[model samples]
Target: MSDAPREIEALIEMMAKLPGLGPRSARRAVLHLIKKRGLLMNPLAEAMQAVAQTARECLNCGNISTGDVCPICTSEKRANGELCVVEDVADLWAMERSNVFKGRYHVLGGTLSALDAVGPDELRIPKLIDRVTSEGITEVILALNATIDGQTTAHYIADQLDGRVNVTSLAQGVPIGGELDYLDDGTITAALRARKSL
Candidate 1:
């Protein structure tokens, strides 16, 4: 039904499959790419192709890397006895962007989801336990999202690591610069419970 050429339509269809992009957005993006082919599309295609060839999961921490081990995992400075646990590579990248956590990370890949049949074996949990012992991790910081499945996964990990290492979770409460009135009851309750000396 599309009046566009078959090749252009195919490109638009492929773009539409990306997250947050619909058919209309994909059409617009495809058109933009076509218009800016010389300036943008060629470079983008080359970069994507290069990344596609080089991108691989780090064997140590499950992070996307161009080599066997990511720079963070290989860095001596990152071996600070604290291991930050995240659900996915994106979470790890976000933490890296903040430049706050000085320790290495363990990406679980996903949380325990009964509906989706996800379990410890499905994630990198076994690898996490192995690293805890092998790397002499003193504390494991759970930075999972505040969701039902995320909490469930955190509890499971805590139980698994109960006596071996100290376990902690990221504080869940009102976000920075967030108005109390705009927050939900759960956020208000958590903020009140986690109240600190001001």
Candidate 2:
């Protein structure tokens, strides 16, 4: 009875599976996009297609990039002898939003989990150590989440880099098991500024 097609409904269903969207919101979004197809939807679809085709992880620091090495990893200016380690790319982006740290980042992809059989090798730990040596890193900051897994990963990294470079972790008030992505930018800056050594 309706003009809307089944293909359009399928797109909405797929969009609803995304993190925050539900069926109601997805339906509304799809309708809105269809209404503004010429102005918004076409460009959005092209951009998504481009990213989907080109996105790849940086071989060095594990940051997402279209190129072999991410911009940060290749930038001479960003080679400030400081390395910020994060559990996820989202966490790295949150730290970048704060603009507090002037160094490159090493994304771990995920934390070490004994329960899930995740180990140091599964993460970018070995690569991080290599960067410390080759990049002449003076400080290694752990901006991991405050969860048990995050802390455990932090300690493991600290131990790995012990006596090699200054190892520090984001200070108190991170909220137990709080994620960097969920924190306000100001809170992230404060936590980074007040970070203490391991």
Candidate 3:
């Protein structure tokens, strides 16, 4: 930052704010992107612009999509009487990467948090309830993390849908206090396969 131009230094600062990036990596990445501006940086910028314009949250399932409904929520093949409830969109993405679950998802946006004053209304919990009934969802598989807040959210949702539909949760293999986005695909698949009733 001491020697770099203001624009480049600003870019590094912004990149450093991204989730997995730090000051050291952000500087290196900015340098790389600047060096390959014609081939990489320009195209990357265009792609980011395109996605920013097109990306949207699916109205039905809460997944990010280019349209009102995500491909999974709109696909007839995915309406298999099953719904996977995830704590975050990132968790939903991780489950998709597993390539094992064929059903659709309901992203709660985040877990229930009393400390932060987050509740069902704060997230998409009400929307999830509506989807279960309207979409004929028979089984809801909870893929939330193993964190305290995650479990609390899971139990809250389970109680909301009690006896109306079969509610289950990912088996106890998920690491304590771990986030789904941090897990490998195989662990996710195994958890899905070993899910137990709530």
Candidate 4:
């Protein structure tokens, strides 16, 4: 039998399931939360509850937002006729942190994968095509990862938008098999500035 109470054990188990936390880390975290219940735990719980209740995906760009459309999608200043496509929201957030790309973004949610049985329909490829024409997009910058699946998805999107808009991919600074979310702000800025046609 575990020494910890059932509720605490359960909380630890759930926390362990998070991206970087394992059993040991989760146990430490749970103990810390219990000690700081009044100051940190309560506020964290309330924040999580509020976000769970209100957070939603943006209908137009697949970005996470509280409303139907994300702030970037609705902002007049972001409608610069340029669209930066990323495989995930983390990449979008990374780009935002870099403050390099002023144009709007299109989050694909995930890349196309034949091994995983993920197709264009499974992603937001069709919606991206629709957005290019509907939004008068003059350029589409693919900031996808350098993985095989990411490259494959970029090529597919390029073909889909061929002859319609100027399609480009991020420059060579991005390491092979590296994800945009892991890149530093300066590298992202440099890559965006040096982007070339696909």
The regions of model 4 sitting more than 4 angstroms off are: 174-198
Across residues 110-180, which tens digit of lDDT does each residue of candidate 2 receive? 99999999999999999999989999999999999978899899999999899999998877557678998
125 Cα displacement, candidate 1 (Å): 0.5
Clashes of each: 0, 0, 0, 0
- Runs in model 2 with CA error above 4 Å? 1-4, 174-198
Model 4 C-alpha lDDT per residue in residues 73-170, reported as the tens digit of each score: 99999999999999999999999999999999999999998899999999999999999999999999999997889999999999999999999998
TM-score attained by model 2:
0.83
Q: Write down the RMSD of candidate 4 (Cα, Å).
A: 5.8
Give lDDT per model, in order. 0.96, 0.91, 0.92, 0.95
Q: In candidate 1, list every pair of residues with a backbone clash.
A: none
Q: Give the per-residue lDDT digits (tens) of candidate 3, residues 69-121.
A: 89998899999999999988899989999899999999999988989999889
Q: Which candidate is the best by lDDT?
A: 1
Per-residue lDDT for 33 in model 1? 97
Better of 2 and 3 by TM-score: 3
Q: Give one digit per residue, the lDDT tens place, for model 1 in 93-196.
A: 99999999999999999999999999899999999999999999999999999999999999999999999999999998889999988999999999999999
